[model samples]
Target: MFVHFDRPVPGWEPADGIRTLVFLANLAAQETTGDTASSTSTERLVHRLVGSTVHDVLALALIDDLPVPPGSKLSDLGYPLVPATGDDDTELVDDAEGFLLLGLPLQEDTGVVEVEFILDAGYLPIPGEVLEAEGKHVIHRLLAEAERVARVIGRNTLQTWLLHSPDEPAGTGEFADLLREYGYLPGLTEIQGFVDIQSNIATTAIGESLPQDASLRAEIIRDLCVPEALIPGLIELYRLASVEVPHGSLDAEPVEWTPRRLHQAAKRVVTTERSMLSVLLIDDSGVIGLSEVTCHPGSDPDVLEQGITIIHPRARGRGLGLLLKRELLHAVATELPAARRIYTSCASVNSAMIAVNEALGWRVLSGGSGWQKHLPTV
Candidate 1:
């Protein structure tokens, strides 16, 4: 039997936290080999792998408490473990043979919630063998719980659920077939992009200089104070640019942004050492182009994750998106020279951004599609 903890990270006991960290660490070890898997210097690897979850939990908690921000509700389910009690203590017994981590998004009625699931490397059977029954059972239970959450947060019944995996395996792969067996239908595709900063610095020099248009200006916003007047423009730009990009499914909506939501996002950090950086192209009208990235100095200082890069519709044709992106790259290189790689995700249909990424020497690491299922009316 599996024990579930619905509480936030701060609520979890030390033992519970340790169990989850060890499970994640082992999972990483399984996925890696050679020097990475070697126990000789695994402390850093474990910190990086397990630290990610901790950061996410803290970031989620940093959002405002009432009227939860859109796309901020995340319910996590850890691997199954037997619960045990001692004379003076309580702890989880991790003698179990399988592991799974599921993160489910609880959205509004008629909205889509994304499902993120991971399994122990061993549980993945080769071509013909049946999928592990234990992992399958855990997934079902998690989905049921997700449905209950959606019902509570939503109107009456949950509407649509989404899952994403590599596009190549969606139709014919074993894992894809398994998801299909349940109720998921393949939907929009996404492209994963990666760039090695050190290698591309020379090629992306245009970013070395700011936008040249006399009417336009650029600035990098970090932990500095945000101007009061520009907040509304930033919110509007987000709404316009984000909606224009394809989300999970055709019906999926971009996150609703409010002034409060914007402030919360700007100030939130996963860890104390984590830094949120945004490169913005502004005009007398307001922010017209933007690029964002985050770095985790405490856990893994060498990797940077790209957030969003958008150019206003009116400002489109001037290569501002590329300008913002390259400028952001240079900013990161200057501020965090230790950063080695930068990662980004773009909807498969966004060829313009994809072309810009290609121009900066970013390469496609993987391709995945969002799959959705519309639940039956209750």
Candidate 2:
């Protein structure tokens, strides 16, 4: 017999179906906390191991379920249903009968919780015994369920698999050979051509500085949403010639720029201790332009230019975009040179920005289908 019950997270709805499968491992096990005579230290360890393994599988499943629209929230989907209590003897028996049947411990708690999970051979995409090994069934089930859910939601399912745990097997060559027999390959593939900050700076610098003139400087300030007091004639003198301004060069018409949003974004860039924020600008008339937001690593300053847009339409054009970016890069190199390798991502479809980044020597490091999934409220 199976027990069905509901448990909700405060201020968050429960995950249902595949989300439940993906998140079940993270859910606090009923036996994880609170006093329980039913659980021994060994049993507790087994619970943790099993829970963590399931959690990882579930995460992949959730990723497969995400919708295609950018920035879709989990709340937009139907809440997941929490698992029923597993502490009872009946549920434990059910668990043992299903996927948890292998390596059944004759004397758990007194000894180790011994069990091996089985993988269904028919479901695997890769042909090999490694994927067919025991304990792989959890991952197989997760992938199968994720694929089913993806089809229902109209999305493609990505492949996900599990390999044997490296640490637990000790130096037993047999266990290693067994995992190898299953042909399990660990880790995801690498992405190429992604831009790091050092490359961005070198490529962006055209070796031509902004011209010095009070009127031109004023125009530049007007284009950027900076405070008038912050605008100094000498600011133009420090202009690095190599920086390439993309938006300012675009033929798009000028848009209204707001100071409040600019100030807030600037504040965030200046205040964040970690290299999670950057400021960029673009100018057209050799005067004012659009400012942009970005981030880099705190430890490795060279990894600058994680682009995040804080300013929207009002500040379009004006070259402030590249200007802010140049200024921030200069600031990091001057103030925090120890850091290396900046990283950023843009939609594969944004041609204008992609052109600018290409000129700056940024490359595509990784690319995959972006998706979003939604569920109506119950």
Candidate 3:
């Protein structure tokens, strides 16, 4: 008797229902594998993102597994059913069938779709198996909603989609097999709860200057500043970064960043209240390497996540990635002394970067390939 919608219902107070579903999905790891440590962290980060960020939320019945309230219609949840095979005589807000599908945008202009089909979990009862006809029905429902919303928002939609599942045996085993058949592969693994440890700045070699390669130098950007002078460098930096995947591989849509895209990205970050820092490597020409870190500062100390840190293939012989990371860490330590924990995710195949992070005293989670740096004190 769970209800799913495109947006929070009329009287839902900041919707604990959405939070509950996220918790349930993540709790699967603890239940199946008994890994309380990572499960706790994943859940915490998910709830934190929903609370601090302006993310779109759907699926409101996870609150307590209750039925849709009486006299409440699908339209009340921000989803209006469109008239199918009609001559324009019907309102799209008609009653829905038994199952409910939900969606929200991952980014405003980016065509990524975040989908949650509660039935897929089988906490209640799904007609068939997880990805049988019933599960596919829910997926198609979400896709339709994604297409409709894309048209209204005037953004290219659904070139990408996120299908979140608990890190349980079922998810990694049979359930994942079904998703792969549908062209939805696991893209991220959540590395959850960790103890914050004090950074040992005394032995840290952060301030060591990079080689004075007459051609290359480094700079850190704060407050979303893209100096008119460095715009070209910034563009190049993003172009190089978007290409290099976790291992020695190229991204599907590699080389997608343009100067226009850069500005659009900066505009969003500038308008938002979060903190972002970028470390750029520049030669006499333009940006050849880049690393970034971001965090949402709150009343107490906050955690920071390292963003993309990539070196152009042409510029990789000189350990530029390591240099930039050290510089980025130094910047974070100095600029955000109040930061509690810093973490970053990398592909399991990327051993080079993992080694560098390991040397920095970052703790690595076993199940997932992510490293976390804790700041027990400012």
Candidate 4:
């Protein structure tokens, strides 16, 4: 006699009817995944937990259903009731089955909400037959609700996320087929990784930076800190670098970059204090290279996720990419010392970047698909 319903964030009704889609991870999958006991995942779970967007929330519970935190709102995720920290949270965790989250950057363009889901490889054959009836079929419900919400928001696409880890968990292939069957597109494949930013490997590499005469300065973008006058420089930057970014497929259309898009992106970063965008400028050229590492919305304060790193073609071959990274690493230590781990991902096809990551002590954690750097705070 199980019935399912979504609880709206209190005091936050969707005037546009784009109420959040609540998806529950059944940690106690009595009928599915054979993970009825209780399982915590670092792969899929960490990425979702790494960085947070302006509008996000991740509520965890021990029950079969998702827990919606009290006083939750679309504008903010109420003070996170962190696990393993205080006695007050014991009651909160004990009350629910698992967690529910409203995650990262909604499509400002289309109003789509995005989320990633994964299961441990050790768990085979996600018991679709047994739980489909218990909770309206978890995966199917997510897709249907996503679609329903997308339609209400007046958009046709529900650009939610679906990641494929290298481990190729037992049921992943089947799950993806089901996703594609449900109208989801295979948009992009990303590698998840981490590295020790303070390790001997990275310190040695940073030491190789060109002497002080190099005349390159790195600045992390903050609250409209990048004057409008400098926007064009970043625009020119996109024109030269975006073509190289890995995309949907080898034959995919070239990304159409625009100055307005660059400005819009820079403006969005200002909304969050934790987001970091490090730009390198040479004395002669306006904007030569840049790197962006955004801390996840509800991510551990000690970590930030890689966003973008690009060096203009004219500035390449001189190790500017390495320089940009080295200097940005300095920014992390001095400016964001409390931050401990830095994770960046790239496509398997990007060998050059992969090589650079290897040199910087970044190891691929997700079956050799992405790189992660562990930044030692001390």
Q: How high is each candidate's TM-score? A: 0.71, 0.36, 0.60, 0.59
Which 10-residue span in candidate 3 carries the lowest summed lDDT?
369-378
Model 3 over residues 233-258: C-alpha lDDT tens digits? 67776766655564221113454566
lDDT of 1 at 329: 80
lDDT agreement with native, every candidate: 0.53, 0.32, 0.49, 0.47
Sorting all predicted structures by lDDT, with the top scorer first, yields 1, 3, 4, 2
Kindly list the per-residue Cα lDDT of model 1 for residues 1-378, writing each as its tens digit: 333323323322234333443454444433322112111122222222233311221100101112322333234433222221112122332333332233333321234444444343455444346667765665565456555544554422222222222334434555566557767776677666577777666655634455556767777778423578777777887887657777645454566777876765555453334577777788877888878887643335666778778888878898778777777788778877777778677877889988999978876555556666666656
Question: Residue by residue across 1-378, what tens digits does model 2's lDDT show?
Answer: 111123322223222321333223222111121111111222222222233211211111212232233332232124332232233222222222112211111211111112222222232323223334433544444334444444444433222222222222221333334333343222222121334446546644422223343333212221234555443311342231112222222122222223443455345433332233323333333323323223321222334444343222344465444444555555445445664544454544455556555655665443322121122222
TM-score of 3: 0.60
- How many Å off is the CA of 368 in candidate 2? 3.1
Off by over 4 Å in 1: 6-93, 96-112, 126-171, 203-211, 223-225, 248-251, 270-273, 296-299
Candidate 4 steric clashes: 26
Which is superior by lDDT, 2 or 3? 3
Model 1, 81: alpha-carbon shift in Å?
11
The total number of steric clashes, by the backbone 3 Å criterion, in model 3 comes to 3
> How displaced is residue 70 in candidate 4, in Å?
20
**Order of all candidates by TM-score, from best down to worst?**
1, 3, 4, 2
In order of listing, the candidates' clash counts read 0, 72, 3, 26
